[model samples]
Each structure stands twice: as C-alpha cells, then as structure tokens.
Target: MINNAPEVLRYAAFTTDPAGGNPAGVVLDATGLDAAAQLAIAAGLGYSETAFLTPGPTERSFAVRYFSPLAEVPFCGHATVATAVALADRIGPGELLFQTGAGPVPVSVTAGPDALEATLTSVEPHVLPIPQADVAEALTLLGWAAADLDPSLPARIAYAGARHLVLAAATRERLADLAYDFDGLARFMTDRDLTTLQLVWRESVGVFHVRNPFPVGGVVEDPATGAAAAAFGAYLRTLGETTPDAVLTLHQGHDLGRPGRLRVELRAGDARVRVTGAAVAIPADVA
Candidate 1:
C-alpha cells in the first residue's frame, strides 16, 4: 500500500491559452488510491471532473476513471484530452489507449508549435430517443420554449462514451442566454442518466456554437466538452444534416469568457467520431 499523496496535474483542454477552455485535474499515478481518496482529491481540486490513471494493457496504455466533485462519471472528454496531453508532455507525442469505465478510447497526441494537442476517437456512437414529456420538462427548467428550438435539428440523446441530451436553439441569441434551475435540472438529469444538455446553435452549415450544462457532474457548465462534440458529430450524421466525412467546428465557452474551440471530424463508413483540441498545463498557485 502506498501512503504518499498522489500528485495532481492540472491542464486546460481545447485551447492553448490557459484561461480558455475547461480545466481538468489529472492524477498520473493513482494505482494505490481508493475510490474514496480519488473522490476527495477531485473534490479538493474543484474542477468539473478529474481523471485518474493506472497501468493498462500495454506500456502506452492506462486504465482511466473520471470523478466529479459529487459523483463518478463513466467518461469525461475534456479530462481525457487533458490527461493525454499531460502524458505526451512527459513521454513524447504518440498513440495511447485508455481503458475506461465505458470502453477503450484511442488517443493520439502531437507536439505542435503552439502546444501539445490530443485527438480522441470515440467508441461506436448511437442516437436514442427521449420522451417528449421529459424534453418538455427540460425545456421548462432551461427557460426555453418549444418555439425556441430549431425544427430542422431534431432533439435526441447521443452517446459516444457518455450520454448527452442534444437541444438545438433556433438562434445564437437564444443559445447565449442561459439561465436554469440548477437543482431542478440536476435532479432531472440524475434520474435520466444524462451528463449534460448539449445546448447548441448552428452559425452556418458546418459551424456551430455550443454550451453544456453539466449538472450531474456538479458543475453548472462545461466550457469545452469533447465527448459531447463527438456525440454531436454522430447526431448530425444520423440526422443526415452533414456528409459522413466532414469537419465540424464547435466554438464553446465564449459566453463564460473562457473561449475554446473543438474540432469534430467524421470519417466515411466509420461509426466512431474523433474530437481534437489543444491542452496546456496550469500552474497550481494561480487561480
């Protein structure tokens, strides 16, 4: 048994700027830590989610778990990107496999001129239907009406690694104005097994802006959500809104003032989706 405290590494994923994007806590060596300890660490860090890693099947692999302040999630995309980039900074850019609670996720990291970037390929993705009554309740909690929704963009639940409810707003103004019943939404999400409500607005055919309300993770919002991005790509494909092979640009976190960008790439005949972004380590002392 190990007694020493595991070191926590902080990284902001989806942007080169430390202030942009979502910040995640990474524990590179948590083999000795129990779930309780991990939870405590995550609670201390106060990020939306923190990733814990142990040795996996191969030298370039790890068994990963994600924890929020309030609960444990099956997967977390921003945390995954943060962990991969942290590993790449130490071990050099290369391919990595993460054995997660949901499934195995393949990731590739590269050292770029600006910073280290990581791309994660999601497992097989699928879209599922949500009860209209539940959707209506969610809309009420979010203070949005049925008329505010985009008719062309159907609402559904999408899963790449974790489940997210996709709701498309008709206009950018509607998407930007975010006010919700936090406790009510959290209860609703818990009962429905949802991670976030992927509130989105299509700026153009291929360009979109998104905001994720992650009540289940004990966070009011997630600045950059890679899992949701992958799921969104699958959503668009399943809806026949985009070609099977195309690049999508997602701009998130701007309203929160921590601007971030996420790249979602879909390949022809491949059910899996890929989300890529840059990550940078944050200083412990700085708030």
Candidate 2:
C-alpha cells in the first residue's frame, strides 16, 4: 500500500460537533509508512496529533502509533478516540487492543444514535509529587503566583500512558486567563520529560474545567486532552480524592473557543482508568 496520506480522515474527538472538540487525523491503514513519513504527514496535516493504525486481523487488536507535528508521543487520547471511531466505520463497533508506545490500551466502541463513542482503558497510572523548585519554575513560566493555586489539589506529576504535571488553579478566572512563556515552559517540561501541563479548576465534586499547555507537542493549548484525563484519574486515586465509583466530567477548551467534554470513569476494582468521548469525522472539503 502506498501510505501517502491515506485519505487523512479528520475527526474531532470528545464532541459531536466538529467546531467543539479537538481535531485529530486518523489513518486507518499505515503499514508502509516509516517514522519519518508519519512525522511528515502529521506536520502536513497540522492537527495537534494524528493516529496511524497498522492493519492486523487478530480480531481485537492492532499496532497504533501517535505522532505530533514535531515528534512521536507514547499515547494520545483524542487520536485514540478518532482511530477507534474510524475502525468502527469498517469493522463495526466493539473492542480493540491497541499496542501503543506506552503500553496496551484497550478500547471499547459503542454505537449511539448520533455517533460512535469510544472508551479507552489507560495503562496502570501513578502520581509523583513535583519538586518545589520545579513547581516554582513552572508557576513562573505560566505567570501564576503560588497563591493562585488550589491547596486541595497540590502540584504533582501524574502518569498513565504518559507523564503530565497537574496544577490546579484556585479560580475559574485564573484558569481562563492562560498566558505562559512558551519557550520557558517547553524547556521545563522537556527537561522533566513531561508531555503537557494539565491545568485545572474544580467546579464541583465531580465536575472540573481543564486546559492543557502542550508546548512539547508544538501546540499552544490542547482543545481536548485524553491522556491528561487518564493521568488525572490516577492523580485522584493517589490522593484518595474522588469516590471509587465516581464519574468525573471535565470541560476543556471553552476558553480556547473550541469547547469539548471528557468523561473520566474510575472503577473501584480496576486499576486502569477509562476515558470516554464521542468522535465525528471532519468534513473533507471544510479544511
């Protein structure tokens, strides 16, 4: 197969409306494309990330690779959702095992009257406290004062399929006004091997607002962040914050003018976190 773009299906995950969610490129079959080719394609597409799925007839699984414009990432939430929905178009909605760089991410697809929904089970997650100095530097880059942080959620680095630092803003206003030193923040995150800075503000017991600064991925702000959602689930578990059977609703990208929602489910017995979202194909000619 020629692997030249492969019809580049565009899908906005975590929202039914294309104008509301994070856009990702989905290449159903990319067996022949090498890493360099994939990177070139992703950069050409110009979305936050793209998911390339290699064909496998094993009934439930396939090797999946995620690439940003500048580099390859271990995992990406929106792209995974887009790929699962894209697969559902051909193979019918069910379960799928994705062998990603991070680990095996099991995705389950369910058909809705409106669109297809995908739920991805993240790899086992963990959280580590961020060093004070590191936190201070990050705060400085973000132009946020330490007093603006929410004491309840403390700063920590959370990992599910990838590593992300979770910083809680004390107020919604603080979360909305996101102006940061791009180069400085990128340097800090790169030095620590962090993927994105998961900035959040808790709205209620089970509802929160989030924004992700993905400088390392060459994006200013991620409209919808699936990886950060999984990592946040782990962070909550580590802190003993949410109820075992709670379903957390995360509203992201509203400030960026593209509103998206992510449903994060935490099971009492399962160590793997589940992140659910709806995905729809972006119209080909719309650009």
lDDT of 2 by residue, 160-274 (tens): 9999999999999999999999999999999999999999999998999999999998999999999999999889888989988889999998998888989999999988899
TM-score against truth, every candidate: 0.98, 0.97
**Highest TM-score model number:** 1
> Tens digits of per-residue lDDT for model 1 on 1-287?
33698989999999999988999999999988999899989988899999999998689999999999998899889999999999998988999999998899999998767999999999899999899999899999999999999999978999999999999999999999999999999999989889999999999989999999988778899999999999999999999999978999999999999999999999998999999999999976656
In TM-score terms, candidate 2 sits at: 0.97
Model 2 residue 199 lDDT score: 98
User: RMSD for each model, in Å, please?
Assistant: 1.4, 1.5
Tell me how candidate 2 scores on lDDT. Answer: 0.92
Q: Which runs in model 2 stand beyond 4 Å of their true positions? A: 1-5
